[model samples]
Target: MSAESDYVTLISSDGYSFVVQRSSACISAAIRRMLDPSLGFAESKTNTCRFENINGLVLEKVCEYFYYNEKHKNSKDVPDMDVPAELCLELLMAADYLNV
Candidate 1:
């Protein structure tokens, strides 16, 4: 894949855009499917994904989790990510939806 295809843009409901590594984002099965080239999804073509139900703040956390997951995939004693208590529910819902 070209350098351009190595990253993807994720847009949130509240109009935030995060440019993240495609491999990192693929930690979420749902996102992998959305950006699968063979699947021919519009998101795959554009390398952009829009989450209508997820706000910017939550989406930002999700993206962080993506990288965190990728970084720890082959390691032991991983550190826990800091999450605000207020975002727990929404993060849980987003995780379920994303099949992370």
Candidate 2:
């Protein structure tokens, strides 16, 4: 692995993994702290976080929202981002886990 720590692998309970840019993933304060080098936490060293309680499907949507938020971070009139009705509860739970 490179020493740059430019990306992070988010591992879901079912072993699904999503690799995303560190910058974009840092949109969540919880994730930001996990990746913060100064914190010297295990996650910061490995650039990965495992959510044994989260399933892949919900995690996927949360990761999408992270990128969406990043793209609209500075926009004044950002368009509404939609989530599937069936995923509302799981999405909310995942958001809480990610502090999104």
RMSD of each: 2.0, 1.4
Q: In terms of TM-score, which candidate is strongest? A: 1
lDDT of 1 at 72: 91
**TM-score per model over all chains:** 0.93, 0.89
Give the runs in model 1 whose Cα sits over 4 Å from its true position. Answer: 1-4
After superposition, the stretches of candidate 2 with alpha carbons farther than 4 Å from their true spots are 1-4
How far does residue 84 in candidate 2 sit from its true spot (Å)? Answer: 0.7
- State candidate 2's TM-score: 0.89
Candidate 1 residue-wise lDDT, 1-100, digit = tens: 3323888999999999999999999889999999988888888888999999999999999999988888899898999999999999999999999998
* Ten contiguous residues minimizing lDDT sum, candidate 2: 1-10
Reference-based lDDT, residue 93, model 2: 81
Tens-place lDDT per residue, model 2, 27-59, is 888889887878877888788889888899988
Cα error, candidate 1, residue 24 (Å): 0.4
Global Cα lDDT for candidate 2: 0.87
Residue 14's lDDT in candidate 1: 91
Q: After superposition, how far is residue 70 of candidate 2 from its true place, in Å?
A: 1.2
